[model samples]
Each structure stands twice: as structure tokens, then as C-alpha cells.
Target: MKIGFIGLGVMGARMVKRFLEAGHEVFVFNRTPEKAEFLVKLGALRAKDIPSLAEQSDVVCSCLSMPEDSIKVFLDGVIPHAKSGTICLDFSTVGVDTSRIIYQKAREKGIDYLDTPVSGGPEGVENGTLTIMVGGEKEAYERVRSLLNSLGEKIEYLGGTGSGSIAKLINQYLVAVHSIAASEAMVAGAAFGLDSEQLYKLLKLSYGQSRMLERHMEQYVLDRNFEPGGAVKYVHKDVKLANQLFEQAGLTETLGKLAENSFSQAMSIGLSDLDMSAVIKPLEDKSGVVVKK
Candidate 1:
């Protein structure tokens, strides 16, 4: 398959590599040309622009940071230039409504659009073990299943347009709330004079354990290396999207609001670039105890 890939960030770059390793001909583009350099060297053809990328590809897959970025890229760059039969798969975690709007507009141009959001972070991308949730026409998804399999260990085609985005929003909601809960739990355990490492071991044996707890506590938080897996800023944006979905569904409030605020506080204190687990820093500061090994 001739593949066009946009947004060469942490996840995007690695995904492109997976395609290349699978022997797919990939045309790559990024706002920053330098980001495409490594992939280009790995046998990807660097597209001068989105139009050039779209001109030669059957599938154009994008993994942007925000909804607005996806909108701008498709509206200004992708839609106008892509061939009529081309399929556009967006792996960005955007609002459901936003994705539906894009899907409708793409249909007008005869471009098949799928809201295909992904989870499992950069590590998952690198290992081709990410979980992909897809929403679009059934036929289009079937056509792209092999391509998706190259990028994810688990891929599901949910209902129509925006369903994948809705699923992703729900995923982010649970992740945010669980992350905050993990932080609070660790901080409270530390405050009560429990060793962080021992507590984490015990928690893993108990009902309180979660993937978030294992990734956040054991890898990043306890080690004091806050390098991003999923950055606080990105997670915060996802939480906001989830909150918007809740409001649209006529819900008054959710625990996501609290998680949203926790991420906001983390960002305000300059933890935006750190891992989402860094939300614990604020709790650590207030309690005057570091949750570390």
C-alpha cells in the first residue's frame, strides 16, 4: 500500500517506521522538515507538502495533537489535494462532534474518513502493540485492517463516524481519574510513613492495581524520571475533550473535572512537558513528602 503519513511527533514517527519495516511505501510530511529526516533516511519518501503526500498515496494517516490541528490539516492540506477514493484515518484523540464534522465534510469531497484514535503511548507505538479504536464505514475499515494490524496488536471497529473518538474520550476519562487516584494513593501512603516501593508491591497484589498505577508509579514516578510517555499537556487536552462530551450528553459533572483540574495544576507548576504521572508532584509538594523508591 502507498501510505501518506502526517504529524511526525513521538507516536507518528514510530508508526511510520513500523509501516516502513512492514515494506509499505510511505510518503511522510511534517510541519518541521527535520522531524521527517530520520524516517526519510529509513526509506520513506519525504513529501514536500500535504498535497504532494496525498497525490501519491492510497491512505493518508494522521496523528495530530489536537482537534484544531486535525481540522486545519484536513481542511487546508489534505481534503483539497487527496484523490477521491483515498481513505483518511485520523488517530488523534479529538472530540466526537469534531470528528463527525470532519467525516461529513470529507464525504462531500468523496474522501473516506475514519476517526481512529489510539492508546498505549509511545512504547506501544514502538512495539506495534497499541490498541486502536476505529469508527467509520465498515467497508473502509475492512480495507484498512491489514494496515492497522501493522500498527496495533488490538484494533476494533466500533460503529459509525465519531464512535472511535467517543470510545477514546471514555478511555481518557478513566485514565485521567485513575491517574489522579494513583497519585493521591501514593502520596497518602508516603505521608503515613510507608515505603513507596513496598506500597507499590502490595498495591499490585491488591484490588487497587491498574495499568496506570504500574506505568506511572513503578516506571516514572518512583524513579523520579518524569520523561513523558503521555505528556501532562496532551492528557489534559484529552480530559477537556472528555468533559465536553459529558456536557453534550447532558451530564452535570464527573470525576474527570477533578482530574482535569489536577492536570491543570500540574501544568501551571511547569510539569506540562513531564509524564501524566507527574500530576503527583503537586500532591507531593503539599504533603512535603516525595513518593519515591
Candidate 2:
């Protein structure tokens, strides 16, 4: 399938590569031309803008920074330019209401839209092991299943137009809370004079094992490599979305709020560029227990 992709961030850049490797004709657009140039070097046709991208491809996939950005690209930029029946698949993690609105507008334009938020971070995208939760038309889901296989190992059609966003919100909540727990547990171990590496290995082997603990906490805390696999700012956005969803659903998730605050605190302390696991810094500051070498 000929595809037009937008947003060439860490995850987006890697994903565009997978499509090219699979022998698909790919056109790409990014707010910055430099990011799109890497893919252009690898045989991707660069679209000058969103409208140009929409004109050039049969299906368009977007993995933008936020829900609002996704809306602007599609509604403001691509909707008028897109050929009727062009598939607009959103891989950004955004709110359900936004997804619903976009889905409706896409349908009215005779376009197919899918809210397909993904999980497993940059590692997963590079490895094609990401988990995808999709929400859109059933027919569209079936039609795009094979294309999605290029990006994820596990894919599920959650329900209607916004179900994927809802599912992703739940995923963000668990990830946020578990990530905070991982940081706190590490700090507690360090305070008690337990080696961070030993505690990480032991906990990963025990009931406290989690995807976040294994992939994020272990690397940032043990290896002291704060390079972002998923940046603190991105996770902070996800947590904020989770908090909004929790409140809208009439449930107060205290732990979710606490996790949001912790990540926000991490961002405030100039850790936004670091990996999400850098939340350990705030914990260290609060308790006066160092986590790094």
C-alpha cells in the first residue's frame, strides 16, 4: 500500500522505516523538513505539507506529539485535500472525545479513520513488537490489519470510533502508576543501602516484575543512562490524559494523580529530556538518597 506518514519523532521515524523496508511506497511530511529528509534518503517521497501528503498516498498514517496536533493535521490540513475514502490512521495517544470528533468528521468526508494508539515504546516500534489498540469501523480495521502487522505484534479492535483512545488511557494509567512505584521502590532500596542493580534484578525476578520496571527503571537506574526511550514529557502528557479520563468517567484515581504529579515534578526539575524513569531524581531529592553513580 502507498502510505503517507506524518510526524518523524523517535517512534515515528522508526515506524516509517519499517513501512519502507516492507516495500511500501511511502511519502512523508513533518513540521520540520530535516526529520523527513532521513526517510527521503531511504527512498521515501517527501510531501511538502499535509495537503501534499494527503494528495500523494492511498493511506495516511500519523504519529504526532499530541491529540490536538493530530486533529490539526487531519481536520485543518488533510481533510479537504484527502481523496474520498483515504484512510487516516492515527497512532497518537489522545483522548476519546477527540478521536470521536475526528472519526465523525472523517466519515462525513467519506474517509476511513482509525484511532489506533500504540504501546511498547521506541524499542517495540524498532522491533515490530508493539501492541496496538484500534477503534474505528470494523471493515476498516479488517482492511488495515495487514498494514498494522508491519508495526505491531499484538493488535486488537477495541470497538467504535474512540475505543482505542479509551483503552490507551487505561494503559497510560497503569504505566504511570507502575513507573512511579518502580522509582519509589528503587529509592527505598537505595536509602536502605541495597545496591540498585541487585534490587532491580531481584524485583524483576519476583512478583514486582512489570514491563516498565524491566524496560525503563532497570536501564535508567542501574546503567545510569538517562537517554529517553520514552521521554518524561511524553509520559507526563499521557498521565495528564489519564487524569482527564478518570475525572470525566467520574472516578478519582488517587494513585494516577500522584503519579501525574511525580512525573510533572520530574519535568519541572529539568528532567523532561531524560527517560521517563528519571522520576527517580525527585524521589532522591525528597529523601536525600542518591540514585546515580
The local lDDT score (0 to 100) that residue 167 gets in candidate 1 is 95
Which regions in candidate 2 have their CA more than 4 angstroms from the true location?
A: none
The per-model lDDT (C-alpha) reads: 0.94, 0.89
Residue 42, candidate 2: Cα error in Å is 1.0
Error of 1 at 149 (Å): 0.7
TM-score of each: 0.98, 0.96
Report the C-alpha lDDT of model 1 over 82-139, residue by residue, as the tens digit.
9998999999999987888888888999999999999988889888899999999999
Best by lDDT: 1
Q: Looking at candidate 2, what is the lDDT of residue 108?
A: 88
